[model samples]
Target chain A: MWFKYIMVKLVLQNVSTLRGIVGVLNDILKEAKFKMTNDGVHMSATDPAKIIMIVLDIPRTGFDEYICEKEVELGVSIEEFYNVLKRANKGETVQIENIDNKLKIITTGKVTREFVLPLIESIEDAPKITTGEFSAKIVAETDIIVTAIDDASIISDELVFKATQGNFEVAAKSEFHSTNLNLIKDKLIDLNVKESAQSTFSIDYLRRIFATSKLAPVAELNISTNHIGKFSFSATDMFRMYFLLAPRTTD
Target chain B: MWFKYIMVKLVLQNVSTLRGIVGVLNDILKEAKFKMTNDGVHMSATDPAKIIMIVLDIPRTGFDEYICEKEVELGVSIEEFYNVLKRANKGETVQIENIDNKLKIITTGKVTREFVLPLIESIEDAPKITTGEFSAKIVAETDIIVTAIDDASIISDELVFKATQGNFEVAAKSEFHSTNLNLIKDKLIDLNVKESAQSTFSIDYLRRIFATSKLAPVAELNISTNHIGKFSFSATDMFRMYFLLAPRTTD
Candidate 1:
């Protein structure tokens, strides 16, 4: 009974859901601490520079099986975890458990494969953000934003997001070249504007966050002038992830 | 009229076919000379180490449009050409031409994009391979071979191929681990062995050569003991390419 209380097991019917989540977190954090509770799994971490913070919550209903007698913290290298998940083929179920301070990942498909990675003690403190009241919010197709990011990336490394009552625009510029993607209200899934807002962010961070677009079809964006911007992806109620990025002050 | 005679233009309906071809060539040669005639395009080059040679031929009938007044050689960096081809989206039409000693690539789909690469002088002589008489030939599903290579790569850096009168086998071994993929006569599309043979080759080379599995469904392998092994991939008579690798003697 004591050993059972200390152990936790999670089974995911489709590995890609977890794979996509870790892929996004790996971009900003080299290591992450996952808090497993009866409710679900949650992780919060920021980049070394504190320019980006990611918060993830996957409810217990999302997993095929979630067993936890007591809350536990599992800290592991994001890189190693990602590498292990890469070995899981499509339609494979992934089983994760901890034994003797080592995390074991077993994928069951046509054949079963197991990978073991050691857990580490995470001491880094999570950054606290006092978010400002957002003035504008826009929901757009994930693929469209990914395309816009790629198009602007060819011109500059920084991207500017402008939201007006009529439209939302993503623009980038260099010395001689500039590209802009304009999406009108008719093109978006939803649009809300209390006041017009504009902000600039690093394309590098934006690209990595959006790389998980395949996991979600739509993205919800919240912005306030000269403040942190929040971009979130979610399914109906299974999982939700939001990334907050600080804007460039000079822009 | 003279400019027309000196210039040649080629158009491919699907960009991925050429993309896949150049992707394989870029693995071995930095620069290569393309001989363009009314009949087709041919390229022959060997790695700098002279341990592997690749010969490629894409017939004129493979293209949607092919124009050549006279046979000419277009020499360019294979690396750069491969990079440019990567930009072409799926289902896009790729058009290539030579203008003022510069090679021009244009892809037409949602938008027309053009890229220019400088032609270089290719002075390296192609390696002549008097292929040894092959005693064993095996044709298997490209995907199966790819999986076998990936499995063996996990245990060792080199792979061994064994053929007998009844079956063909791919095997690899390390100090503590070993993997083997055995295909009997019924398992393979075709297997013929005049005499039993065993050979070893660098897994690094085999991996790259097999990366083009997406371009073809079946792969034909020809091998002889202690000699060069030839692996070829093609789609009927439209195009054919083969890789010849010298086997390790000490094995």
Candidate 2:
């Protein structure tokens, strides 16, 4: 039998943050693997198409009450979890429990609702990613990137990120239309570049990464010319999420 | 030549009202026929499936500036019109002009956007609807009906509306679940029933009609047992919309 005792119980005062996190994760991957430890909860997954990888960490302090008896990993359907969270009001308190290989979620609002989702076996382990020497790094408002991506998406499928000593620009162009957005040093929280670097990435993946904009106010971007890029979005002290994407060559 | 000069030019201080009107119409019909006159703009259509008919009247006072040189009827793709409106900020002014068999929409906000959509010939004339004497009438908050319809939709494809001397109730039941909502006389603006009346209607049509809830505060419901029903939603003096639906007989 796969039945087991209750291993993890978490209570959240507000479900908005969790909703935001799950919403972004669902956009990147259909299923997610959640690791619960004494320290906090962690989840990471790569898109099935192998274009983007996302890592998420939520500290114990982020939850009102988090209890984990032992280190355990559970597999959850990101889409189903997100749909259940949609039922919760922003101010509602959410309670989650793991029992007998099933995950139970309870939300307290004008009316209390409960949902039980069966747990599946975890997928293959996440790949170990190594960092590459980046030539440019910039920290800017999340809205700046999100809005630019949205605007560019209207015209083209690919967007270019150009970084220099003084400015970071996102531009996209098609045969008939083009959009260019510039973020100067004055608008960035931090900017560092040894030399100018430009790279293009798929706008589809960028949009999924930017879905976290509602949860965080700022995002740190690290890019190398014609290589992979990383985006780290931080939401105050609540949580931190990282996204890594491969760049498309100019061939 | 049909092309002579601009026939209608309208500037709206806010595009939200127009968005609301189009959103609901799009759900009912794909193409919409709009009739422009000196008094205001009018649109009426019956669903392609012939299940429901809707009529919209927006007065001249609703617009910041309204001009009409001659009466003209234009056919527009509701889905395309909605996509253009989506670009306008809720608080932004939208200027619309009909010129050379095309509708030009300009929205001014933090940025200005212009979209030109070609107008097709009117599809067909709106049928004249003669409503029978209704035995039950109730005026209630739009949100109440919208919420009840949404809740009932979760369990059944049809919902029954029952009106007694002092209470208006919306109820739906399936094999496994049921929902009942009651709006008493005290909670309604007005309620009048010569005798008890009950009728069932398709939730699909109800949802499309209630999509205009955000545009109006109150809806006047008129119905007779197992007959046709009319829902009249009015937003202050800006616009008035009427939805007529044929009830589904239980037999």
Candidate 3:
């Protein structure tokens, strides 16, 4: 038991990366299982309703100090972890260690603060998705998508994403108000269309997912007709996050 | 009735001044009666609990366009007025007119937005306080008091202000922690101690009042033993706001 407790210990030069990751996870999950391996820390969780799945990876190289004797799983309340991380100030170093069913977090700066949370029993592993054959992929500046989402949210709960041979569009319409954002291939960072496809998704989920858009400047979107939409972004070189959301059916 | 409708027509070059004024009033009164005269717009109201009285004055010179054919009493929900003012973008001009029984608020920018709120019957005029002779007065940088309030708020819901011949102190004590901020006469912008005095006040009220400290750079405080405390600040040259708060009894 003592040896197992010492197996996983890591220190982050800055807590913001983990904070952003936890912010995204906490939006879709109450509790999450994080797997710590020699390579990195990883988590894949699906909301209870099975409408969304989030996969996160933070490479071991990103940590200031990383030591893992063997692979280990740490299950914790995401909300609690996020709350503790939020207390960290800029330039503070965050240290994490596992000891006797407790997760210890220490932040060192001008002042040192420590918080502890009891670890819970590990839940069933998250099911991984075999990447589907997406008909179209579009890459755009994160601000464009974030701004489009904000504009659409003013009028409707769902947004329609359309990819055609020459342009991409995000639009929403209610009985009284409508907003449309059209980006031609020349305007986007990159755009690929095997065949024209359109999908509608909940603005609620997109809003939560993109809340951390400041962590990354660009996002890649994969979509197909009336199917799941996959969005991916890398925060600096430290970590990458992926979100899979099921599309809403339009009558 | 028709003549009264046209009596009050005022335009503010920048809505931010009124926004800041309404922000402070809305914190204390849900429904406020604003008296507009050729001199300016003024309001004096006491909280329902009678624990705090706020007097606000905005001179006619502050308004970009002041056309008052006659003095008019406009009574409206402070909350609704505050919400509409919040919608104004920076540099947007705000036009206010008493039309019939409604208050018309128009914001002109790149886009023009208009909101109408029905006027309600005016409440009884606020009771004016005859200035009292305080034994001590202290003038300090607003940042000092604002910071002191924030520090005390972490420990207790009430703060004790002690003024002596040479210095002044703001302090709070809780079961586990205590915070004290001591400022000597030389450290303050100005300090006058005719007779030493001490008073305890609700931190909740101070916190709300000081939230608008950005609008003012300095504040003056008057205190007497176990009596009302008067705190006043000017939000730029546009307005002067005074808060008179009754002290909390101490054992």
Task: Output the number of the lDDT-best candidate.
Answer: 2
DockQ of each: 0.05, 0.04, 0.03
Q: Residue B131 CA error for candidate 1 (Å)?
A: 27
Worst 10 residues of 3 chain A by lDDT: A172-181
lDDT tens readout by residue for model 2, B176-241: 799999988998999999988999999989998888888888899998999889999987669999
TM-scores vs. true structure, each candidate: 0.55, 0.56, 0.53
* Candidate 1 stretches greater than 4 Å from native: A1-6, A174-176, B1-251
> What digit string (tens of lDDT, one per residue) describes model 3 on residues A61-115?
8799998888889999999999999999999999998876889999999999999
How does residue B74 of candidate 3 score in lDDT?
88
Better of 1 and 3 by DockQ: 1
Model 3 lDDT vs. the true structure?
0.84
Candidate 1 per-residue lDDT, tens place, A1-251, comes to: 55753477889888887888888888888998899899998988888888888998999888999987678888888987886777677887988887667776777765455566777876475877878789999999999999999999888888889999989999998779999999999999999999999999899999988987989999999998877999999986578999999998772
TM-score: the better of candidates 1 and 3: 1
Q: Estimate how well candidate 2 is docked, as a DockQ score.
A: 0.04
Question: Which of the numbered candidates is closest to the native, going by highest TM-score?
Answer: 2
